[model samples]
Target chain A: MQNKLHYEFEHQAMATQFSIQIVGEEYEDAETASMLCFQRLDALELVLSRFVPDSDISRINRMKSGDELLLDFETWDVLKKAIAIHQKTDGAFDIGVAEYVDVFRATKQGILSDFEMVNALQSVFKKAQNASIYVDPETPKIYCVQEGMTFDLGAIGKGFALDQLSELLEELSIKNYVINAGNSSVLAKGVSKNASCWSFPISSAREEFAVQLNNSAVSATGTFFQGDHIFDPRIGQNICNSMYERVWVSSQSAALSDAYSTACFLLEKEQFNELLQNNSEIAWIAISENGKIQFFTQKNIPLAQYLIS
Target chain B: MLAGTGLVLANPFTASASVLSANDKVNVAIVGCGGRGSGMIFNNIPKIPSANLVAVCDIVESRREKARDRFYTLFDKKIKAYENFYEMLEKENLDAVVLATPDFWHMQHSVDAMEAGLHVYCEKAMSNKLEDAKKMAQVMKKTGKLLQIGRQRRSNDRYRFTHQILLEREKMFGRLTHAMGQWNRSKIWTMKPNKQDKIDISKLKQYGFDTVDQVYNWRNYTKLGGGVVSDLGSHQIDIFNWFLGSYPHTIYATGNNSYFNFEQADTMATILEYDTPNGPAIGIYENISNSRAIGVYERFIGDNGAFIISEGKDNKIYRESRVKSDVWQKYIDAGYISNMADMKKYKAKQSGDSGIMETAPQISYNINEMRDMDKVYNLPAHTAHLYNFIESVRGEETLNYDAETSYKSEVCIYKIHEAINAGGAKVTIDPLEYIV
Candidate 1:
C-alpha cells in the first residue's frame, strides 16, 4: 500500500471553494480536523455572508440610523478588520460601495445604457462617499450612524475565513497545512511534506511567479471575473482605465492580503511605494495597464518571497 | 457575587441598567460552555438587550473558565463560572438557564432548571431517548414555567414569514402535497480532542464521559446522543412538522454504517407520512455521510407553488408555470415575495429582442420579508429565538417553540431512528404519541 501522509478536504463557502490540506497526520485524524474546520467556516458564513438573509451583515444592512446592534464576535472581528483596512487603503477598499458595485455589475449584462450606468454612479456616489460605520473596540457592537449603508464582503470574506482557519489549525495541533480559497486567497502554516515551504504560483496575463509561503497569506485580486470596471469608492469613479490588470499582496494575515490586493488595483503607481513603506511587513506585485509586472518585498522576509523579476 | 461560592449573583428582574429597565431584562446563565453554548454567549445573548448573562457552568472546568475569560475579554464584562450545576443553581439567582449540553444531559438539566423556578431554553432533540424528551416536556407543563426548545428556525424571519403569511394566510402553496429535506455531509468521522483543553478523566466520568473524544463528539455515540438524526435531522425535520401543523403517523427509514462503524446511522433516509390540514402529505428526509451533494434545505411542494428554504443560503420561491405571473404579483406588492424572473421575458431580453428584465432563466423567484418583519427580527436566528424566550420570561411574548410543541418533532425523530435500526421497517405511530 502506498503511504498517505497528507489529506485534502474541500468545502464551498462565501461563494468560493475552500480547501484544507493537512500533512504528517493520519488520514482519519486529518479528515476529522478538516471537517471540524469546515464546520467553523460554515458557521462563520451563517453570520458573515450577506445573502444568507439572517446573517449579521444582512441584519446590519437592515439597520436604521442610530441603531446600536451587537454582532457575532466573528462578524465583529471581520468588520473590525475591514474598517481598519478601509482606513489603511484610504477608502479604495470599501464594503459600503456595494450599491455602486451592483450598478457596474448591472452594466455588464448589456441591458443598461451607458448613460444609465454613468447616472447610477453619480447618484450613489454621495452615499458611498459619506458612508460611516463604527465599532466599539471593547465589544463587537456596531453603531450605525447612517442609514442605507449596503455592504458586500465579496472582496475580503474568503481571506477572513482563511485567517480564522489558520488559527483553528494551530488549535488542532496540526503542525503543517495549506488552505486555499477560491484560488485567489491562500494561507500556509508550518511546512509541507518535503520540509520545504508551501508554494503556489501567482500569475498575470503575461507572467507568473512561484511564491514560497508559510505562516502568511498571499491574495491575488483582479476584475476579470465579473466585469473589467472597478469603482474607486473614494471618488466614485470607474477606474477600469487606471486599474491594474492584476494585483497580489502578501501579509501576515489573509484578511490583510485580500483587502490590500483589491485596494492596490486602484492605487496610482507613485502611491505604491509609500503604502508599502507604511506597511513595512507587506509586499505586493502589480501588473500595470501595459502588462508590466512590478514586485516589492521588505528585507528579512523569508517565507512569503517571490523570485524578484 | 455569591458569598463563599464561585458563582456570580444573578441580577434580579428589578435590577436596573443603563439601557433598559431591570424589569424588562431576564437574568440568564448558560450551561455546557461548549461550541453552541459559546455561540449563545457571544453571538446571541449580546444582541438581546433584555437578556443579561450572569454566569456560565460546565462539567469541564477549563471550558467554563475559558468561556468566562473570553466573555470578559470580548465584552469587558465579568461573569461567574462553575463546574457543578446544582451549586450554580443554589448560588446564582437566575431567572432562566440556557442549556447547550450533550443530548443525554438535556432532560436532567432542563427539568432541574424548571423545577428551580427558572425558565429554560434547551437545545433540540431534547434528549437521546424519546421517553426522556417526553419527561422534559411533561415537567414544563407541571411547573408552569417557560421552556423553549432551541428549534431556532421557528423564530427565523424568513421561516416565520413563510409559515405565517405565505402558507397560512395567503395559502400561497395550495393543497400541500409533498415535502423533502436533506443534510448531506461529506464524511462521518470521529472528533479529535482539542490539544489545548486540559481534560480531567475523573471529572469527565461524572458527566458520563470517559474520554475526551466522547465529550467532543457525543453525537457520534449512541449512548450519549441521538446520532445524525439528532444533530442534523432534528432541525430540518422539525421544519416539516412546523409548516405542516401536524405530526407524521407513519415512518419508513433505511440506513447503514456504509462508511463508518459508528453506533449511529452513517447514511440514513426516512419517509414520513403526515396528515396535514390540507391533506395527507408525504415528507422525505435523508442524511448522507459519504457525499455532500445538493447541500441542505427543506423543499415544500403544493399544487399552486413550491418554495425551498433553509437557515443557510438556499432560499428561493418557485411558481408553477401554469400559474400566471399576476397571481404572485400581489405577493410582491405585499413584500411577501419579490423579483420573479420569468424565463420567457429573461430569454427574450437575453437575445436582445425585448426590453424586459434580464435575469437567470428559471421559473424562480426571490422571496422577501416585509420591511416591517425585517425591522422586528434584525438579529441572528438564535438571537431571535433567545430574544423570544427572554421576552416570554418578561411576560412580553410567548415562546416560538415551547418544549411541548417540540416534543412532537422529537417523537417523529425517535421513530425514524427506530425504523433505521429495524432495517428500514415501516413503523406506524398513534397520533396520541405526539402529545406529552
Candidate 2:
C-alpha cells in the first residue's frame, strides 16, 4: 500500500475563499500545481467578475440595446452554460438579477435610504420579467435586445471556477483532489487514502450528518450567512422566508449542482421532486426551518442505509 | 512669506540664509512632458504641498504645450513651456527637475540638471546603457546633489513596513531562499494622438524620433527603451536585490519578440543567482506582453514564511505551516496579520468548521491604513515615491533609492539583457562591478 500525504492551499478569489486539497506523494509539485490552479481562477475572475469595471461581463452589462459584443471563449462558454441551466431549472437560475443585487448591496453599504430602496426594488421587479438577453449560437457574441438589462454571475461563477480548476489539475496529471469554494460549492475526484469515497459533513440547526461522495460535485445554499441575499428571478424578489434553511445538491457537474441547489432552495417539495425526477443525475438533501432533514436520491443504493453501513 | 512663516536655512550646506521659509515652496520643472511626465504633473505634483510647477520642457512643442495646458487647467498656474531642457535649466530658478525622458536620455538630462545645482528625480531603467548609468551615478557623487530613482515600491508604506519593520526588525520570513516575479499584459502599448495635438514631422525628426508612434511607444524599441527585461523586470528584480541584500552573481536569460513584431523583445525570462548572508538564493522573473493572465506581483519565499507584495491590492503575507502557529498568532493579535477570510461578518449556524477545509495552516496579513492624528490617508505607491523625492529635496527625508544603490540592480538587469540579446547565454558578474 502506498502512503499518501495530504496538502492544501488556500487563496481568496471571486470575493470568497477557495481551497484545493490533493492527496499525493509529491508535496512540492502539488504546491506548485495549486498555485497554477489559483492563477487560472484569477484569470476567470478577471473575465466573469461583475465588480471589475473592465471585465467582459461588466462591459456586457454596460452595453446598449442592440449592441453586440464579442467575448472570450471562457466567458462565452459560461454564459451558454448559464442559459442552458436557466431553462432546465424552469427560470430558477437567472443571471439577469444585477439590478436587485445592486440595490441590496447599496442598502447594505448604507448608501441607499429606505424610500430609495423601496423605489429601486419596485423598479427592478417591474423590469425583471422582460430580461431580453440574446446570444448567438454560432459566434461568441452577445446582443442585449432590451435596454436596462444586466448580469450578475454570482450564483454560477464559483462553480465555473471550480470546473476550470479541475481542468487545470487534470492537465497537470494530478488526480485524487478535492476543491471547495467557501463551503458553499465543492467538487471531488478519485478518493482519499484508505476510503472508498470522500466524506463531507453537512449540518443544520438541529443535527449534523456526514455524506460520502465519489467523483461528484456538491453545493449547499442557505440564508444562514447573508440574510435574503438570494433572489428569485421569476418574481424579482429575495426569497427571504423559505421553508428550507439549507439545501445541498450533489451531481456530476458543479455548475449544475450549484444552480439546482440555489433553485431548489426556493422550490416547494412537490416541485423539487418533479425536477429531481427529470434530472436523474442530481441528488438532494434539504434541511427545513423546523430542523427537519429530508433526503432524496435516484441511486439504487439507499442513502440512509449507505450512511449507516 | 517671511512674516507669516519663520525663515529657515534654504540650503543647509550653504552659508546664505536667503530668508527662505520652509513653506516658501520649492520651484520644480519637468524635462520630458510625455505620458509619464504629464502624469506626474497631473496626478502627483498637486498632492505635494511644497512643490511649485515652474516650467515644462520637451523637444516636441505639442507635448510641452499639452503639459502646460494640463497644469494650468488643474492648478490654474500658467507655467512656462520650453523646447530644450538645458535652456529650461538656464532660465528657470528651479530647485528640482523630474526627468521622465526616454531611457537613453535619462543620463544626460539628469546629469545636466544636477550639475546645474538642481536635485533630480529620474524615472527608472536609469539609462538604456550601463556606462551612461555609471556616469550618472558618478556625477551625482561628484555634484553632491540628491538623485532619486523612480523605484516607487521603495516608498510604498506596505513595502517599507515589510522591509524596515517586518523583515529587518522582526526577522519575518526568516532567511529568504527564492524570489519570483512576473509582469504580464495583453495587447501592444500604442497610443492614438488627438488630431489637434499633433506635432510637426520636422520637430519629431529633430527629436530623434522617426515617427509619432515611436514617441508614444518608445518602450517597444531597443535604442529608446530596455525591452521587457529592463522596462518591466528591473522594477521587480530591484526588490529581490533590496530584500535579499545582495546582487546577482550569475544570470541566464532568454527572450523573443514572438508575440509582437516590434524592435524589442515581447516575452522574456531571467534567472538571477544571489548569495545572501543566510545562504545561496535565486530569483526568477518573466514578462509576457501577450497575456495578462496573472497580472503583476513579486513573491519572496523563505524557510519560515513567504510574502506576495505588489503595488496592487493583491499584497499578502503568509506564514509557513512548519512554523509554530503561536509565533504567527502574536502578529494576528497585534493586527500585523489578519485572517484572509473575514469570519467575523458571517455566523455559521452548524459549525464544525464552516469555511473551506485546508490541510495546511495559512495566515494572511491585510494592508492596514496609515493613521495620523485625525487624518488617515492611503496614498498610492507612485504618489508616495514622488512625495519622498519632494521631501528629500527639502532635506527633510533621505531618498529611499539613491543613484548609487539603484545602479547595482541596473547592473544585474543589464547583464540579463546582455544574456537575452546573446540568445540565452549565461553571464557572470564580478562582485566589484556591483559598486558604483
Candidate 3:
C-alpha cells in the first residue's frame, strides 16, 4: 500500500536472500521489475539447481553420448562464465568438483568405503585434466569432446543471476536501486535517498564498515555460517576450515567479487594482495578463524567514503 | 570475400547478423575441461536463452570423467567430451566457443575454432605471445567470426558507464590532463613439485618445470603465463586507455622481480603519453608485487577534479580547482595569460582579479550521485552491453562492443607492454591498425 513510485523488495532464492531497491516514475513498473527479477531467478534455479534431479544441467549429466548438446541460453551463459574464471584461476577455483564433493558427502554419510571414495575422487580429478570445452559465440552452441566432462556454475551463478535481474530492472527504466543477495554479493544502480554512496558495515557488530557500492557491484564470500559444507575440490578439504572463515569483497561486479573472495580465501595474504593490485576496484575485508579482520582498499576509494558519519 | 569460415552474413557493412524477431536459441560449446572452461559453462547458466551445452573437450580422460559425473550428480546434463580441441571443433557444429584454456593456447584454439566455423569468446590478454595477438586479429578478419576477448570489463555496465562519462561528458573533469593506475600486490604461493604425485610430471619437463605444481602455478612464472605485467597490467592499463580517450604516443617503463624472484618482471612502473583532441596528456601505471601498498587503483586528474576507480571497491571523485593568489596575479601579469591587458596599467590586477579569485565548486561524484543527472542527461548508453548481446541473439538490438571495440582495448594494452619493454619509449598507435 505504499504510494511512492519507488519501492524496496526482498526474497530468498539461490539459497540466499536477495533484495532490490527500485526507483522509477511508475510504482508498478518498479514492482514489476522487482517481481520479474525474482521470477527470472526462479527460472534460473529450475535449470541450475543441484537439488533438481530433472533440471537442464541434470539432463546433460544423464546423457550417455552426444557430439553436440543443446541447452537453455541461461545455462550456457553460466557455463561460459565459469569456464573463464576456471581458466583464469588455473583450477584454484573450480566448479567441476561436484563428483568429489558428492563422494566427500557419501564418505561422511558412511554410504561408501573410505578407500573406494578416495579412489573415486582421484579418478574425477584425473579425468578433469583434458576437459577442453568452448562456447561458440555465433550460433551460441556449447561444444565438448571429452567424455565424462560436465560443467557446474555454483560459485558464479548468483552473480550471473544478479546481473540478469539488474538488466530487467534497467529495461523497466528503474534506477536508484541496490540488489543485495544475502550479505555477500550486491549491485547498486544509483545512490540512496542520501547523497552518500550506498554504505554497509562489513559486520553488524563492528562500527567499521565499507562502502557496499557506488553504482558498481559488491560480493561477499564465506562458508555457510552453520556448517563446513563448502569443500575445495583441489585438496578435498573444507575451505572454511583451512583458511579465513569469512571474506567480503567489493568490486564492480558481483561475479568477480564472488570469484575473487573465494579464490582469495584459498590464497595466502600475498596472493590476495597481488590480486588486489591487479584489480583496483576490489576492496576487501577478511576475517580469519581467529577473529582477526584485515582490511584492504584500492587507490580509487578514500578512507572517508566508508565512514558512516 | 569471406573472412574465413565462421559467419556467412549477407551483409558485412553492418557487421550485426540480421535480427531474429522472436527469441533465438544459440547453441554454444565449451572448450577445455579445466577449471576455467567448466566454470564458464556454469556461470552463464541463467542469462542467455536456448543454449546447448553440446560438448566438452580435455586432454586427460580422468578430468573428463570427473566433469561428466559432476554434471550428472549436479544437473543430470549429459554432454559429449573429447580429448583434442581440434576434433571437437571439427565435429561440433557450434555457433560459438568459450575458449577457457590456458593463456598459451588461446591463439591457436581461437584461430582453429574460427576456421571451423565457430565464433569465440577467448580468455584475456588476447594472446599469450605478441605474435599470437596479431594472428588472432588476422584469423578473425579472415573468418568473419565474432571474437570477444575475455576482458569481461568491456561488458561491465559500470565500466561502460564510467568510460562514457569520462569521454562524452562536458565539464565532467574540465580538460583531464594527468592520471595514474596501480596494480600493487603481495607475494603469491610458489608451488613446489611434489615428490609423490598422482598425475604425470613428464609434461612438466617439456616446459622446463619439474612438477604439476609448477604447471598449475604457471602465472607466477614467465614461460606459460604473462607475468604480473600482462596478467594484471593489461586490465588496468586498458582502463587508462578507456579513460584517456586515446592511446599514448610515447611510453617508458622499469620493472623488477625483487619479491617473487620469478623469471619475468613481477613489479613494474610504466609512463604513457597521450594527446587528446583537446590537449596533451600523460599517465603512470605501476604494477608492484612486494606489497599491496596502494592495492589496485586508477586516478584521473583533471584541471578541476580527479576520478578514482578500483575493482570490487567504490568509484569516487576527489575535487581540486585552481586557486588565485598574489603569485598567480603576478604570473598572470607577467605573461601566463595570453590575452591580458598591461599589469602596470591596472592596480586591481596587482591585488587580485575578483573574477579570477572565485573558487569553483567541487566537481566530483560517485555513481550514486549521478542518478538525478543520469535521468536528465540520458548518459551511459553502453550500459546495456550484456542485454544487447542477449537481445542480439534474440533479434533485439545489435550487439555493442563487438570485436572491433574489444580489440581497441587490447591494442592499448599491447602498446603499454611494448612501451614498458622499451623502457617506456613513446609509441604512436594508429587506431586503424587494430580495426578490422
Every candidate's DockQ is 0.29, 0.01, 0.02
Would you list the clashing residue pairs of candidate 1?
none
Candidate 1: lDDT over CA atoms?
0.79
| lDDT, residue B296, model 3 | 67
Candidate 2 i-RMS: 25.3
Question: How would you encode candidate 1's per-residue C-alpha lDDT over B357-399 as one tens digit per residue?
Answer: 5552444676655544533676778889999999999988888
Runs with alpha carbons beyond 4 Å of true place in candidate 3: A1-309, B1-23, B33-35, B60-68, B191-198, B201-214, B220-223, B319-364, B369-403, B406-436
**Ordering by TM-score:** 1, 2, 3
lDDT (C-alpha) at residue A133 in model 1: 56
Interface RMSD of each: 14.2, 25.3, 31.2
Pairs in clash, predicted candidate 2:
none
Residues A1-309, model 2: lDDT tens digits = 357788888877888899999886377667767866776787678678876533668667766655655555567778888887777777788777886777765455444544456677777665555545666554355666655557888888898888879876775677789999999999998877657668888877787777776788888888888675567777776665676778888886787788788878777777766787788768654555577677777646477732423
CA-lDDT, candidates in order:
0.79, 0.75, 0.59
Q: Find the candidate with the highest TM-score and give its number.
A: 1
TM-scores of all predicted structures: 0.88, 0.57, 0.48
Q: Output the lDDT of residue B142, model 1.
A: 99
Model 2 whole-model lDDT (C-alpha atoms) = 0.75
